[model samples]
Target: MSVVITQVFNGFSLGSILLFVAIGLAVTFGLMGVINMAHGELIMVGAYMTYVVQQIFAKYAPQSMGYYFFIAIPVAFFVSALLGWGLEKILIRHLYHRPLDSLLATWGVSLILQQIARTIFGAPNVAVLPPEWLDGGVRIAGVVFPYKRLFILVFVILSIFALYIYLTKTPAGRRIRAVTLNRDMASCLGISTRKVDAYAFAIGSGFAGLAGCALTLLGPIGPTIGTYYIVDAFMVVILGGVGKLIGTVLGAFGIGLVSTLMEYSTSATMAKVMMFALIIAFLQWKPSGLVSVKTRSLD
Candidate 1:
């Protein structure tokens, strides 16, 4: 029973990581309908930013290094958000209705970003040391739960709650949803669809950065770190349902739990293969995904 409980907790922790990575992606791909191949690069950028922040603290304020993570989070978000805003204004804005072109352009951007990271940070992986407070685990009922993992779970919950509040309570968020539901109608009603797109893209990119920051607690990060998780992020969004927050949450936990259990029972490679096969079969039955988003169509 203790082992089972531990495994379940581990599954939730894994699910939290996936949810963290995919939440931003859901906003970008689901709401905007753009296949942003460069989204992972943005995550890389965030991780780099966190490293940079850590270095700054280590060099200038070693005494306060333990609290550097709190500062790094916002810094990563803004840096990535700024880059996303610029990308939207300069390139993505022109390719709004053109998915293929957007994909190609973003793919090129991802390559460029990866190369830039290599040039700046070298090709080797870099490690970010966790704070002293998060160095150990707590034991409950003979089961150990790591503090880092617990932090991630809590962070994901707070992020989702904040997002829910923003989307449901704020005027800017309402504008974003309105544009998403019916771009033409939103525009007709005097909402600046283009501006909403930019805002939404930046917000999504910012969330990706937050995920990157959280990742530092897990392992060493490299220029290609984002590439490792991008596909999984996309899978979560697709399996959940485009433009559906609740679905994204459910899909992330569902995959995480199933994948962890499969890995425990079998091999990692087989687990992945089995998971993919299951997803394929599930999609065949429900093409729209777990929760379908209903949008207003002019046609």
Candidate 2:
């Protein structure tokens, strides 16, 4: 029973982590319908950004090593956002209506990013050490929950709030969503569709960056680490329903819990195969997913 309780808790944490990654993918795909195969590389870039900050702090400001994470959050977001923006301007913009072309281009971009990382950071796994404040665990009723996971869970909540505010309340977000819902109408109403695209892409990339920062708290990271979860992230977004925030959240947690629990009784490979089989079966009934998002075309 204790083990069951522990696994459940772990499942929630894992799901939340997956949510951080999936939310970004959901937003980008929802807004542009671009299959961003390079999205995982953005996560890897954010993780590497955190690692860079750690190394910098360790060298010049060892006394403030504990504060490295606080600093890395914004830095990673900014750097990753820039990269995302650049991708949109240089590559993605050309393939807006060509979904297959976008997929291939981004897949190639992903390969390029992986090679770049290997060239700079090598083929080994790298990790970031947690802050002193995040070094402990809390045990309650015989269930031990790590502080880092708790911190990540809290981060997820805060991120959701921030994202909600951004997408629903902010002008820039509104412009992006407006463009996404009806590009012709939005442009007719004086919104710069191109700029909005750049902003949406940047914001989506920022979420992936933030996810990578949270991942550093969990375990060792490698260039391929993001790829390991990209498929799952896509699964969550697809299952949740594109562009439905609440649906994505529920879907991420559901898949996270089920996958974690299944891996316990079965092999990791089998758990993945079974989960995917389940998703395929489920999708056969509801091709639109758990929630249906309506755009101008759908409407």
Candidate 3:
């Protein structure tokens, strides 16, 4: 029972990371129908950004390791947002309404970004050492859970909560939702669809970057590391209804728990195979997703 609880916590941590990563893809793809294969690359950029921040801090402010994580959070947001903005302006903007084309274009962009990262950071994997404060585990009823993983789970919950509040409470978020539901109707109602697209992409990319920062806590990072995440993110997005935050959360936890349990019973490869098969079965039952979004046509 203790082992199960420990694995459950571990699964929650993994799910949290996946939730952060998939939320962006869910928002962008669900809202705009633009398949962003480069989404993971944006996440890779965040990990690299964290690495760079670590190097700088270690060299100049070794005593302030704890503060560096705090600083990296916003830095990751901005760097990834900036890159997302550029991608929106350069590539994604033109590819809207053409998901297949967007997929191909974004894949190309991902390759380019990967090559650039390799050139800059080299092909070798880089480790992201957590601060001393986050090095230990906390015990609860004889079950030990790593502080780093717990922190990530907390962060993910908070982030999702904030996103939910923003989506439900803010005027800008309403406009984004309006546009997402019906772009033509939103335009007719004087909403600037293009601006919404830009904002959506930026927010999505920022979340992806944040996911990358969280992932560094678990293991080493490399240029292609995002590839590992993209599959799971897609699975989450597909399992959850696109553009539905609540669905994203549920999907993350559901997949996370099931996958963790399967891994315990079988090898990692077989676990993955079983998970994918289950996803296929689930999709067959609910072709749209577990939670489908309701929309109204302006006409």
Candidate 4:
């Protein structure tokens, strides 16, 4: 019983992490239809931003180190958003109609960003100190729930809720949805598709930043930290279906739970192999993914 409970918790925790990594991809790749291989680097940017904020707080405000995390979250989001906006303006905007080109371009950009990170932060992994408030765990039903993991789960839930409200209730978000559904129609309706694309991409990248901030609690970070989660992120986005929030959520948790249980019963490598095989088989039967987006097109 205790083992089952622990594994459940572990699965949810892992799912939340995968969700964070893929949530942004749902927007960039799913909605916007741009293959952003550099998405992981955006995450790396956020993690580095958190590290920088921690250093700043430690150096200039040692007495208030506990408050550093509050500041780091926004800093990471905005910095990565700014970078995303720039990338879209300079490069991605041109490749929207060409997925293969966008993929290759973003891949090159990712390499550049990784090299820059190596140049600045060196090749060593650096650890971020968790806040004092998140130092311990709570025992529930004979299972210990770490505050850090719980915090991540709560944070992801809140973020997703906020995002849902934004997309459903706000005018800007409606415009984005309009463009996503039918770009020509949205443009005909006087929506500025260019601006919408930039904003949507920025928002997606910002979410990746938040994911990076959450990752700091788990382990040390490095220039290659983003690489660790990229494949998983892509898998979640693909499995869940593009531009479908509920699907992403279900897909993330599903993979998380399955991966955890499989790892318990088999080696990690075999578990991944099994998971991949299952996904491939599932995709073969349902090529559109778990959730298919509905859109009208000219026949």
lDDT of 4 by residue, 153-188 (tens): 998888888878888999998998999988999999
156-259 in candidate 1: lDDT tens per residue? Answer: 99988888788889999999999988899999999999899999999999999999999999999999998999999999999998889998998899999999
How far off is model 1, as Cα RMSD?
Answer: 1.5
Residue pairs in clash, model 2 = none
lDDT of each: 0.92, 0.89, 0.86, 0.92
Every model's TM-score: 0.97, 0.96, 0.96, 0.97
Per-residue error for 32 in candidate 2, Å, reads 2.1
lDDT of 3 by residue, 89-120 (tens): 88899987788898999999999999999999
Which whole-number lDDT from 0 to 100 does residue 229 have in model 4? Answer: 85
Model 3 weakest 10-residue run by lDDT: 24-33
Task: Compute the lDDT of residue 167 as modeled in candidate 1.
Answer: 82
In model 4, which regions exceed 4 Å deviation?
294-299
The predicted structure with the larger TM-score, 1 or 3, is 1
Better of 3 and 4 by lDDT: 4
Candidate 2 lDDT tens digits, 1-299: 89999999989998999898887897888556889999999999889999999999999999999999999999888888899999999999999989999999999999999999999999999978978899889999988899999999999889877988999999987898889888999999999888999989999988889888888998888989889878888889899888788878988898889989999999989998999999999889998888896657644
